[model samples]
Target chain A: MKKIIKPFWSYDVEQTEDWLQEMAEQGYILKKLHRASRTFYFEQAAPQNLSYRISFDRNQGPVLASRFLENGWTIAAASGKWQILQNSKPANEIKAAPVRQGVITHNRNVSFVFFGLLFYLLGVLLANLSTLVSSWLQDGTVAVEPSPLWAITYLFLALTLGAIGLAIYSIVKIKKSNQAMLQKESGIAAAKWKSSQPTLEIPESSGRFVKKAKLGWMYAPDRLESWLEKMEQQGYQLHHVGTIGTVFYFVKGEPRRMSYHAEYMSTVESSYFSIYEDAGWLKIFESWSAMEKWVIWCREYKEGEEKPRIYSEGSSHLKRARRMAGLYTVLFLPLLFIYAVNANREFQEFINEGAALSLFGLLPAIAFVLFLSFIYRMWAYYIRLRKNYSVFHR
Target chain B: MNADKVMKKYIPMTETAFYILLSLTEPRHGYGIVKHVEEISGTRLHLGSGTVYGTLTKMQKDGVITVFADEERKTLYEMTDLGKQLILAEIGRLKELHRNAVKYEGDFL
Candidate 1:
C-alpha cells in the first residue's frame, strides 16, 4: 500500500480525475481517502485501463452511489460528499456518468460559503487596521509587537486569504466545465423541431467572413444586439458566434431584416431553450457568465411580419434596463467610493508636495474613471431603452 | 407559507411553474417532474435538472411543497395546501386568459 498526501486535490476535479487514472494505469489503484489530511491510499494492482470520474453529491446519499453501481461503476474511494467512481470501460464508451447538476450546485454553494469567509476575513483585517490606527494616533511612531504570535497571526491571515482566492478560482473553473457540458446537453446543443423555428443557419458568403471583437459585450447587451441587427441590414449577416462569445463572425450577404436579443438569465432553468424556441427564436451564441447565462437569440422575419419579443409589449424591457442600472449602482457604489477617495488623496499629495505625478496615484484616477464610465453607460443604456419603449408605446 | 404571499408571487404563473405544480397531482421526485413535464408538453419543453432542483429548493423553503423519503429513500415531493391554493388561483387566471383569447380570436386572425 502507498499513501500520498495532496492538499486541496478536489479543487480541480478534472485534474484529480486524470491524476487518479494515471496512478491506476501504473498499477497503483486508489483504495481509500483521508478527508481531513488530504491523503490518498493506493493498493498495488495489475496495470489496466480505467476511467475515473470525480463527482460531488449535494445530498451525499446512497441514491447516487447505488445509481453509479447500477451503471457498472466501482466506488473506488469516498471522501465526505465527493466520490471517485471508476469504470472498466473507457469514458467514451460509458453510457452513464455522474450528473453535472450536483457538481454545479455544489460549486455554487461552496462559492457562497467562501464569500462569507472572505467577508469575515475582511472584517478581521479592518479590526486589525483600526487597532493599529488608534495606536498610531496615540503615539507619533509606529510600534511593533515582539511576540511570536504576531508572525503567526500574519501568516494565518495570508494563508486564509490564499485559500479563499483558490476557492473562488476553482469555482470559476467548475463553472466553465459545467458550461462546456451544458452545451452538449439535449436542448442547448440542438433546438428540437416541433415545427416552425428556423435552424441556426450560418450563411456562407464564399470566404467573406469578418470577425469582430466584442469584449465586455454583456455590459450593454441591448447595444450589441442592435449593432448586430444593423450589421444584418447592411448585408453583413452573422455567420456564427465565437466559442468564448466575445468575437462574432459575420458573413457579407444581401441586406436582410433580422432581430437580435441578448438575453441575460440570472439562473437558467431547464426548459429555457424550448419556450424561446417554441416562439421561433434561435440560439446564436451562449456564454456562462459569473454563474449566470447570457444567450444571444436571433430570428429573421419578412416585412409586415410581427417581430417576436420576450416582452411582447409595453415598458417591461425598459423596466428591466432600469433594474439592471439600479443593481450595478448598488454593487459598484462602494468600489467607486474607494477609488474616488484614493484618487482625491493622490491629487492632494501631488498638489501639496508639487512632486512629479506617480503611477500609484494615477492608477486610482484611471480606475475611478473606468468604473464611472461603466456606471454611466448603464444609466445611458437604461435611458435609451426607455426612449425606445416610449416610441413603441406611441 | 402564507397562501396570500404565494398567490401574489405566482399569479399568472410561468409555464414552467404551472407544469411543475400540475405534475404534483401525483407525488413525484425531482427528475420525475422534469420527465413528466416533457411528456405532458409533447417533448417540446426539456427542463434542466438545475432549474427543477432550484425551483424545488425554493418551494421547499417557502413551504409550498413538502417532501418525504420513499421506500427507496428518494425524496418524493408533493404540494401542500398553500401550493394547492396557489395553483388553483393560477388556473383561475389562466381560464380567464383562455376565455378572453377565445372571445377576441377574430380580430387577431
Candidate 2:
C-alpha cells in the first residue's frame, strides 16, 4: 500500500528566500543537490516508517514536489523546461550531488509615501500632545493662564509635517532601490532564459575574480587570505599587493600599489564598509579604483553579470542603524519630554503664576511618537528577515 | 498586572524588549517593535534581534505579550495588562530619573 502525492499548489513565491525558509521550518532536510537540473532533493521520514522525496527548484522559488509510491524514487527526462518533473522515471538513472549543510536560514524592507503619511499623522499627535501638556503644566492658575495649547499643538503639527516629509523621501529612496534590484533580477532572468541553448556549457574558472581590475574591493583582509588559499588550490597564483590600512589587497600575481589615501568616501553609501573603514581607504589608480569598484569589477568579470552581492550590505547597515535609532528614541523621548517640560524655565514661569498641571503629561506624547516609528520599522525588518531566511533555507 | 513580579529580579532589560513592551500600547512584531522603539525615543535607543528576542522571551515568560494572533508566520504581539503596568512603572521610574537629571545636570535630552 504505497502512495505518491503530487503538489497541491504552485505559484511564484514573492520572495525565494521566504519560501525556502518555510520549507526548512517544516523539517525538510536537503538529501541531494541535483546541480545539473538546478534542483535539490529533501528527505523527511513520514509519520509511518517510510521516507518521502521533496524536490525544490532553485530558480523557481520554493517549489516542493513530494512522492512516496512504489518506485524507489521517481525521475523524468531532463527536459530543461524549469518545470518540476511529475511523471515517474527511474532514480538510479539520475545522478545527484552530495548534500552540504551551511545555510541556516533566519533572515528578515521599506516604503516612503505610505509610511510618511503614517509617521506624519503620528508626529502630529505627538507634537500636539507634547506642547499641550507642556503648556498646561506651565500655567498654575486655570482662569488667568494662557492655555498655550494651540501654540503647542501647532508646533507639534509642524514637527509631524517634517517627519512625514522625511518619511516620504525615505520611502521613495527604498522603493527606488527595490525597483533597481527587481529590474536587475528580471534582466538576469531574461538573459538566462535567452541563453537557454542546450549546446552551452558553463566554463570552469578556478579563480575567484576573473577580472584583474576589480580585485581591490574583493580583497577583504579577514576572509580573503583563506579564500585566496582556496583559489591557490584551484591553481590561481595568489599575490600580495601590499596593505591599504586594514584591508590587504590580493591579485592573481604581484600587483603593486603606488599610493593609498585614507579619506572619507562620501559616495560609498554603505555604512558596513564605512564602519569597516574609520575613513574610506582609496587605493591609487591603475588596478582597484575603490573597494566598491573592485567588487563591481569582480562580480562582473568573474561572477558574470550576476549583480554583486556586497552592494546591498551597505544599505542593510544603514537600515539597521536607522531602526536602532528609531527604537531608542521611542523608549527615551517621553523621558526626554518630561525632563524638558520640568526644566524649561519658560514653562515653570507659567506654573509659578498659577495654572493646572498634569504630572509629566508631556512624557507619553514623546513615547507615542517613538512608538509609532518603532511599529513602522519593525514591520519593515521582520518582513525582510523572514523572507531572507526562507530563501537561504530553500 | 503583576508589577512586583517583574521588579522582583534585576533583569538586564534588553534595549529591544524593554523597548518592544515599551512600544506596545499597540501590536507589533519583530520590525514593527524595533521601529516603534526608535520613533518614540527620538533616535535614542536602537534594539537588534538579540535584544528583541530576549525581551520577547522574558516578557512572554512574565506574561507581558500574551499571544495575540499570527500575521503570516510572524507572531503579532500585544501588551498584556501586566506588561502595560510594567511599562507604566518604567515610565514613572524614568520620569523620576528625568526629574533628578533636570535638577542636577541642568539639561536633559
Candidate 3:
C-alpha cells in the first residue's frame, strides 16, 4: 500500500484524475481517499491503463446513466461532494460522460465565497488609504511610522489577499477545463497576435499609431464591438489596449472585414483564453477588473463567412443582461435612497421655514436624476436583449 | 400547472422535449428514457446522457413530471396530469401537421 498527500487536489479535479490514471499505469490503483481529501491510499496491482472522471453532485448522487455501468465504468472512490469513476477503456471510446455543468456550478459557487473575501479586503484597504490621505491633508502626518498593530493588520491583509487570490485562480482554472468538455467541435486554428498581453507600448516603426479613449465602453458591449469592427474596416487595425482598458491603439493597415466580440464573466479563468484562442478568435484585450471582467475578442473574416459567437445561445445573452441589470440596481439603490432623502430634507426646510434654497442643496436632486437614468438604462438594455430571445418561437 | 398554462409553455416544444415526455408515459429512469427514445425512433437519434439529464431536471421542475421512485441509485420519473395533457396537445398538433403535409405531398421534389 502507498499513501500520498495532495491537499489542493480538489482545486483541479481533471489533473487529479490524470494523476490517478498515471498511478494506475504504474501499478498503484487508488482504493480509498482520506476524509480530509488531502491523502490518497493505493494498493499494488498489475499495471493498467484506465480512464478516469471526477463528478460532483451536491444534494443527491451524481445523475449518470445506469448504462454507464454496463459500459464498464465503476465508482472507484467517493468522498464528500466528489466521486471518481474509472473504466477499462480510454476516454474517447466512452460515448456517455456525465454533464460537466454540475462541476462547473460547484466551482463557481466556491469562487463566489473567495470573491466576497477579496472584495472585503479591498474595501478595507481602500478605506485605510483614504483615511491616511485625509489625515495627512488636515494635520500633515503621513502615518509612515508603522505601529505594531498597523503592521500586523497590513501583513494579515496581504496574506489573506494572496491566499484568496490563489484560490480564485484555481477554481477558475478547473471550471474552464470542465467547460471545454461541455461541447466538442473541430478546433479552429488560433490566429497568433503580435502581443499576448495588451498594453500602451508600441514600436515607433510599426505604423502611424492612433490612440482612442473610450471610457465605460463595457456598459454597452455590442456598441463597443461594432465600433471596433468599423475601425478595422477603415484600415486602422487595433494594436492593443490601455492598462485599464480605457484606451485603444490602432495601427494603420489595409482595409479588411473583421468581427469583434466582447464577453463578460464573473471570474475569468486561464483556460478560458485558450478555448477562445483555439476557436480562431484573436484576443485584443482582457480588462483588469478584479471581480467582473470583460474580454475583447476579434477575428478577421470575409463578408459571407459565419460570424464567430462567444455567447452562442440567445437565452444566455438574456441571462447575462438580467444579471448585469440586477447587479447595478443593487449597487446603486442605497445611493439613490440617500440622495432622495437629502433632496426631500432640503425641500422641507425651504418650504416650512420660507428659507431660500442654497445652490449646494440642489446637488442631491441632480445626483438622484442621474442615478435614476442609469438604472433605467440598465433595464432598457435587458429588455433589448430579451426582445432577441425569440420568445414565441422557443 | 393547469392545462392551459402547460400547453402555452410547451405547445411549441423541441423534438427532444416531445420525445422525452412521450417516453415518460410509463415510469422510467434516466437510461431507460434514452433507450426507449432510441428504440421508438428506430435508432435515428442517439440522445446524449448529458442532454437527457438536463431535460429531465427542467421537466421535473415545471411540474410536467414527478419523481415516481428512488430505487437504489436511479430515480424513476412518471408523467403528471399536466404532462398527459401537454403530450396529448402536442400529439394533436403533430397530427394536424401530418395531415397538411400529406395533403400537399405533390409539392415535394
TM-score of each: 0.56, 0.25, 0.58
Clashes counted in candidate 1 amount to 2
At residue A57, candidate 1 shows an lDDT of 62
lDDT string for model 3 (A1-394, tens) is 8999987676667788899999999999988878585888899999999877777765435444455665567888878877788889865566554434456567667767777776787787789779989999998977577567887877887897787677667657755654454222112222233344345566755656888999766567777888988898899888888878988888888887888877666644332443455445677787655456677888777778766555444554566667777887898899999999999999999999987888898899999998888788778767766775676346
Candidate 2 docking DockQ: 0.01
Q: How far off is residue A41 in model 3, in Å?
A: 4.0
Query: What overall lDDT goes with each candidate model?
Result: 0.71, 0.40, 0.70
Off by over 4 Å in 3: A1-5, A25-27, A34-39, A57-63, A66-71, A90-101, A121-207, A239-244, A257-320, A334-374, A383-394, B1-9, B14-92, B100-109
Better of 2 and 3 by DockQ: 3
> Per-residue alpha-carbon lDDT of model 2 for B1-109, expressed as tens digits?
2567676542434345466777787656555766677799896765543335444544665666654222121234667666776777677877887998879895644
Q: What is the Cα-based lDDT of residue B13 in candidate 3?
A: 78
Q: What lDDT score goes with residue A165 in model 1?
A: 83
Candidate 1 per-residue lDDT, tens place, A305-344, comes to: 7655555333445655676678777878899999999899
Tell me how far the alpha carbon of residue A121 in candidate 2 is from the true structure, in angstroms, after superposition: 64
Model 2 Cα lDDT, one tens digit per residue, A48-82: 22222222322222322221223233332122323
Q: Chain A of candidate 3: what's the TM-score?
A: 0.61
Fraction of native A-B contacts kept, per candidate: 0.00, 0.00, 0.00
For model 1, what is the error of residue B5's alpha carbon versus the real structure, in angstroms, after optimal superposition? 1.7
User: Per-candidate interface C-alpha RMSD?
Assistant: 11.2, 15.8, 13.3
